[model samples]
Target: MAERELDPTVGALRGEDVEDRDWERVQPRRISDADWKRFEGYAAEILRAMGMPLDTPGTAKTPGRFLSALFDSTEGYEGDAKLVTAFPTECRGGPDCEISQVVEGPIPFYSLCEHHAFPFFGHAFIGYVAHEHIIGISKLTRLVRMFARRFTVQERMGSEITNALSRILQAHGVALYLEAVHLCTQMRGVRESEQTTRTTFWRGNYEATPALREEFLAIAGAHTNGHRS
Candidate 1:
């Protein structure tokens, strides 16, 4: 049987923030049964073509599951960053309050390694200095999910998360660190006994001042040597 770690599935996408745009408008209107059958058959063929053993019990459902997982992983295209921006957290001074604040996150995330489409899973630690606004803590994780659920390489994911904070929070500074393991590499290919991948993006004040940057890195357990804990 195919084994999965069974991490928490994001519960039904609730909250008024979720948009109801009809995705069907952009997708194919129809696929005939014959066509569907051919397409479905292509699933197994794809793995077989990739040199994956289909006869293995662990892979029996992989063809069907892969198709489902592929679509689900790339669903970020449907999200609007503006949705969260619309209701920017109100400050006592009404989003004009500036404060140097750190939002540390041990937030869990999941994504597909672009090179393999196998799972990459782990946590992100984010810290930012808010300017005129304090975002809901939940939104920080949402931001991480927003950026992760898109087509991106690991380096891009790290930078995009920090970039989003700078743009939305109008932050004075932001620091984001991503530590995730790509199962495609670890379990399928040349397995390394240590070290997965670590990517970080420090922007604005985080980049301009060494002390400020070090403070954030210290919190993330990152070393000046470009290594992470």
Candidate 2:
């Protein structure tokens, strides 16, 4: 990945002090207030046409709350990804340190399905071979969130995570395995339950070395299955 200045917003997201309430204040950078008003109008019209009473207890606040939640999930539209922070590698043992493949999380993420405008959500497991630099594990989770909180397909999201990790950490290899339950598939169309969409992506040494790739997959697979049950 091409080097760039670390983003402060990314750091804020990683901070323990940052709370869920803070997200309510975020506004979409691309959409204007006028545009939001227009959307609100259209949303209300749709609800009315669908025989939903705007004044009903169940449907009240749906227009505003729905759009707010949508934009909140896709906060990357407001430049969240650019805020990622990178720090120097540290080892207690000093100059001579072990280079290892770091496996991190079943970091839970939710994303909008670009095709149906629904949602697909699940855990993401990331593994990368840290060459000279090791990224903070919390930052890795934040990185996953930054990419996932947007309109995307599961396959594209996996590729984005792999590429971002490779570039951000300058890792020798990177792999991401994402398994998600897509609402587009579950709530409509075939409407199948207990079905999942899995996507895998890798680059650098992971592509060059078969063993490295297989090991990461094996470990990630175990983690995925454990979470599923």
Candidate 3:
């Protein structure tokens, strides 16, 4: 990954004070008055045109809440370096320390498919040959979860995951492998109902040699032979 100044926003997300709910709870996000008004204006008008009363007990605050929740779902749009930078930076530049491949979960993630606005849910495996430095294990999972909430497309998500890992670690190489079952496909009337989508990406040394790549994949627990087909 090309080096650049670390982003403060990323750090903000990783800050100690950020609520645990911010990353885990998929709740309705509070939206601005202006945005809510605009959304409700259209929603109310549409309901009125269809001769439905927007005043029902179950529906009165629905529009505002719905819009707020929708925005909240994509909250990863607010990406920052808070979590990544929170890791000690000393390990990276250490002159005499050795590099090692660190495999990170099986980090479970869920995100809306950009095209259908339906969910693509799955686990991610990340591996990086840290150049005398390594981040906390939880931070790796948090980072994957961050990108999962941010992007609409798996390809983009995969790239973002790869870039972020490589960027923050400034490693010898990084590798990410993702497998997801899209609700839109499996539950919806799609041809490949039984199939799941698989995406993988790597950067630096991991991208170069098949042997090195497979080594990392094995460490990252990429299921191959003798696994469910």
Candidate 4:
């Protein structure tokens, strides 16, 4: 598979050369039905070893259900072909061109942490300044869910969304903010239930202009605080 290029500005924010990693290797591969059956059996055995009452009426199907849910939750690995499609911008160019930021926010998403396999869920806010093309509004939600369904860290997921949008739209700028409550953090280790993780990524013009970044953040932050309250 061909490697996708990460946006340089966003990559820099990550503090590493993102091109070093082969993203395709981390995506989900097709699993045969036989393989699934074998996996189910292994899961059952593991649950039994863990002292789970597999023979009980309620627990007998728990292994199968668990595997099914996991498969569904990580469906982002399948990839979305429609993500790259764009529409002609409404704004006409020249001196009369009125360029502005398009923002979509509070897009709910859920994902499993790669390390703990525990759920992290919350809202995403995306903003981009269009160039010659603009994407459909609903595509933003799909984009968020696509990345969110993968088994990954919060920071990486935000970067993926930011970079993908920047590449697809070739936008003048791209901005993304993610706020989530991670079960891995709340349900284990120190077990701080009140904790939540927030991540932001800015690229192109958004990075160059502090006003634009702050505007996006203000809109996203207002909606987030209001939604939670």
Candidate 5:
């Protein structure tokens, strides 16, 4: 079977205007005061239709609060400006030059499932072999959160992160692993409380070399097992 090509537009870190990007269909739009008022009214009506009492003082503002929280949670639509920057690699050429995987892990993230709008959250482990540059350590977390904050599926999220890292670093390899507990399953449908979803993505050399993939997995597993080094 042929390997799938990574979406070149998956990560907009190159300062590309993402308004028309297919991967990020939910473009940021102006939400005026009138829009908020209209949304709050709709929320209240929806709650009432669902038999939620909103007349009580405690519940009176629930609709507005709900709207605010929902919008706040999906703020990934507004891309992070800090993600656009990268620093030159410290790896020196010559006999001393040593290229290795750069891994950042246990990045806790919360995301709403596009299927149900219920939250599925967990930690992400990202590994990449830099070519000419390296991203800031903190930006890894932002990268994960960028996709997570949207209504997304785990598979797509992993792909976007992998592709984004590859694009930014022009990396030789990129690997991403995500393990999340979906409330959609726990709170509805089969109600499998203990079930968690795991997804992985590999690109470039990470996809070509099994040992490289395994090495990345080992590091991620060690951290997950609480043996951080």
Candidate 6:
């Protein structure tokens, strides 16, 4: 198991802002039986090599559980990021049609550490300004989860999420912040536990304009350090 915590401040949107909003949960596709069988066999072999007695009642289901978790962490498991059906929403852009809207909150995520295959889990903060379109708050959260539930580096994950949103929504700007505690670092190497690794990605106005970036950080309550777009 991995230590994953979302800061209470992640979803700091005002009550009225989220109320009346239809937040639909994404349904996960089922993993195939063939894949499950293969993974179970492999996991059992690894456990046997690790000196685990698989015949024991308590241990019998460990391999299946481990395999299930590994696949579930990726959400789609054998597929790509789930397709998001976004609806048309009114944007309150000014005369120039430059609208600044931000959806900030904590979204739970977990991933495998490429270095050691241990799990790293934490929260991600996302906010964006709109040009012609504004995404629903629920979609933003789903997008973050879709990207986070895959095997990738935190830096790349942040970047990928930003790019995906920008392309899908064609927004004027986008910003993302990820903070996670890696089990690989906690249980091995230097064994540091208290510190967290942070990664950020920004694009369009949030990248070219310092004020916009700062405002986003202020809203998301993110520390502006080690930013990568």
TM-score to native of every candidate shown? 0.68, 0.79, 0.69, 0.83, 0.83, 0.73
lDDT (C-alpha, whole model) for all candidates: 0.64, 0.72, 0.68, 0.79, 0.77, 0.67
Model 1 residue 212 lDDT score: 69
lDDT: worst 10-residue window of model 3: 1-10
TM-score of 5: 0.83
Model 1 has an lDDT value of: 0.64
Tens-place lDDT digits, model 6, residues 126-227: 877765456676767677766667767788677767766665555668888788888877776576456788787888777787877777767666432323
lDDT of 2 by residue, 1-229 (tens): 1233233223223344343213224544777899998998888888789888999897888887778888788875454433345566654443233325778888899999899888899988888776556777788777778778889898877876776566566666788888899888777668646688888887777777787778888888888888778
Runs in model 5 lying further than 4 Å from the true structure: 1-28, 90-99, 227-229
| By lDDT: ranked, best first | 4, 5, 2, 3, 6, 1
Whole-model alpha-carbon lDDT for candidate 2: 0.72
Better of 2 and 3 by lDDT: 2
Candidate 6, residue 61: lDDT: 94
- lDDT of each residue in 43-134, candidate 1, tens digit only: 98988998988889999778878766776787655564333441334444432343355757677788877787777877888877765445
Total residue pair clashes for candidate 5? 0
Instruction: Show where candidate 3 strays beyond 4 Å.
Output: 1-31, 41-62, 86-99, 221-229
For all the candidates, what are their Cα RMSDs to the real structure?
Answer: 10.9, 7.2, 7.5, 5.4, 5.8, 11.4
Summarize candidate 5's per-residue lDDT along 19-83 as a digit string, tens digits. 32333343564799998999999999999999999999989999999988899898887777666
Superior by TM-score: candidate 1 or candidate 6: 6
- Candidate 4 C-alpha error for residue 135, in Å: 1.5
Instruction: List ranges where model 2 is wrong by over 4 Å.
Output: 1-32, 81-83, 90-99, 189-191
Residue 115: error of model 4 in Å? 1.0
lDDT of 3 by residue, 1-229 (tens): 1123343223224354254324333444466778768888887777668787778997787767766666766778665345654344455444333335677677788899888878888778787776634677788877877778854788988877776666566567888888888888878768555676778898877667687677766755545322334
